[model samples]
Target: MTDRAGHRKAAVWGAGGWVVGVLGVLVALPLAARDRLPDRLATHWDASGGPDSSMPFWAATFVPALIWVAMAAAVVLVQWRARKSAGGAAPGWVGATLGFGGATLLGAQASIVRANLDHTDWREAGSVTVWVVVTLAAAVAVGAAALWAGHRARVTVPPVAGPTMEIPEGQRFVWLSRTSNPWLHVTAAVTGVVAVGASAASVGGLTGAEAVLLAGPLALATVVVLCCASVQARVSEKGLDVTFGPLGWPARRWAAEDIASARVETRTAAQVGGWGYRLNGLGTTVMLRGGECLVIRTVKGKDFAVSVDDAERGAALLNSLIGQRSRG
Candidate 1:
């Protein structure tokens, strides 16, 4: 689309989305007011022990709707500004705004449902789960819509040179593209799914047996994610890119020359203080849990770390790579 056309389209969508959102809020406002009513005034069944007669439907509706309105307004504003940028920038912002707004609305609904449902009772077995599914689906839909809209607004073309690996001296940057692994990505995705499920179940007051069953999946996923991920690293001429999340890049990089020394470091969860890739207060990082890691100290004494199956071997490989590059 032309810049003017794209701008106009974005503006229309933004305005319409905001309008719909405002309507939703107006519809929901009555739910929130339910909390204000005396106990005897509540006509709906209160067996769930939800906040008594005060449970106003309008208030419940309004809170989420209000949030959506704000998000929609932001989206419109971004769309208006995008006309001048005339490229992919405006689309990105609009899509992000839409996705963010949708998420806020979904979150508001979730909060309300969570407050009303007693998932621990098992009597509400399907209720909370259904709401959870809806919320997740809605969030995904919003994100997908944003992505689609953003794509529509931009010209589609692959980069002529892709990403560069030319790291200049004194610059603290690393590039890792050649080492993207499909297996590691799969493992991370599985881990996240398990973790989220377990956490959700536990949150619903599933203590003792139920909690164990729910939390068990999460624990297992966490362990598997950490264990399977410890050996992988993304390496390029620029630097090493570490992997943590399932679907995308979850690493930070550093320059080769800045790395003054290289070594393998072994650490436990307690010593490293938990799992995944983390930069702690001491400007140090521990990748994964109970694994060997390639630890490189920068000239500034900061650590650039990556998890690899053979830490020493990885460190040696890194050293050799750096040496070759420097000599060349």
Candidate 2:
């Protein structure tokens, strides 16, 4: 409990400090160079890396800061809700977003200020291609670092006793459960539509960079749709078998002997990270939705969890099988 409290406190302070610092830098950079900047700052660049859109000097300064604040608020709200629901710290992705997004915004804001400095008009500002590339690279580095830190700081939950079923001699027992997230199905459908549209557009004469952009999203959406649609969990004498997606080609299995223990746990998306497959301090969780999950500790001391209905019974049966194997 003390460790959990400390983790929560640290997360809050780290997020708060990072938000304030990023916002401050975003707003301060433009103001500090106000005298040397143009009346209008070049805020948008065309595909050719030429300035094509401009905003007033003051707008350029506060707009990015406001955007950053809004994003930070959304992330904080997610963390707060997760804490309330599961009493766990927000997932590592939250910190990664703050780190990468904050750095990207800061870099872009600085680039705009630098590009507009000493220019009489926004149109005369130089291209920011180099700055954009560098900013993205730095953002990725920061995001990865934040993810690592979050994973390291995670507090592991202690083992808990779970329900068990009595296995009679010469009797076969098997349990099966499947869980699906409707929201994920909706997302998959939407992305699939967008991907199909992009493919059609590409075939209909959209070429060059535009087609390339469409292709990237098309491939990404297809992968998301395929992987995150649904999940199935089965437990029997063969142990636990978890298959994913409609085709179920990607699957995970654990032998009865490999399982150290089995338990039913109440988990939330915030605790395990967002929907789909997640890896955090707690362990790997196939999280389709929030609520009851079948959690098992492996002989190697690793943990794996899957959300499903009748998880208590499934866990009980798995434990029973483990006991039978030990006796045999």
Candidate 3:
């Protein structure tokens, strides 16, 4: 088989092996300690690090496994569709998701088991705060590793020569394009609603520690709603200008002289490390969706890209401007 086919096979097997391994570990941990565990396990903890929910021993073991299975299936389906459409190896996000999700589930399961071990009653389980923090850190590290591996595994495609526009002397040109992810918009709306609710709760009666918990989520939600919902790209004689959100106060600008080259390239969320405003091996990318991106190489040898419609024209205009600036 060709190298491409081999890579695809490896990706499939790798994902399958990861899924099975995680599932096995999730099931085995609880069963191994069944004798030492209570009839029910402390499965949920509240803000105070106290057990506020319990699940039957068997339920706790199988429920997480089931959730893992469902998530694996969804990831597999998405990768399959992407492979079929792109006719390339699995996207990097697939590995990242599997790594992150599997590690997170395994960590949470281990924490539950450890907390409930030797306890006659589920309510007597100890706080999982330390374990939770450790788990989060481990999961993030594994996810980053997996993403790097995927990037290394990717088959590099040769960059194609992009179309360039001819500019007449004394003529003016400007290009503008906007891109938005509906999913991100929905996410922002949901987070905005939560922030509003939390603000109301804080004002209504919440005080002290209770209000502090609300404050964290409220601030996080507001930031997400403001910064990650949408993006707009504009190219003019001045250079490339990118703005975030509806108000567009926060923006990035590249002056014409600072741009080394401008071109149109196709990029996917998986290629640039998933979702909005990503930094990875490919440099910084404002990825709203997978399609044509206006990519620029700065004079400082850094790369920047933004997913946008009619990227070809935008890139052409930017190139024209750069050429004119260099000649002058």
The regions of model 3 sitting more than 4 angstroms off are 1-164, 206-209
Off by over 4 Å in 1: 1-232, 277-283
TM-score for candidate 3, please give it.
Answer: 0.49
Strongest candidate by TM-score: 3
lDDT by residue (290-309, candidate 3, tens digit) is 88888999999999999877
Residue-level lDDT of model 1, residues 49-115, one tens digit each, is 3333323444554555666676677766766677557652555556655664555454435344434
Per-candidate TM-scores read 0.34, 0.48, 0.49
What TM-score would candidate 2 get against the native?
0.48
lDDT of 1: 0.48
Local distance difference test, each candidate: 0.48, 0.75, 0.75
Q: List the residue pairs that clash in candidate 2.
A: none
Name the better of 2 and 3 by TM-score: 3
- Writing each residue's lDDT as its tens digit, candidate 2 over 194-301 gives 543343333322223685587688668756654665676878778999887644547899999999999999999998888889999999999977888999999999
**Which model, 1 or 2, shows the larger TM-score?**
2
Least well predicted 10-residue stretch by lDDT in candidate 3: 199-208
Question: Residue 286 of candidate 2: its Cα lDDT?
Answer: 90
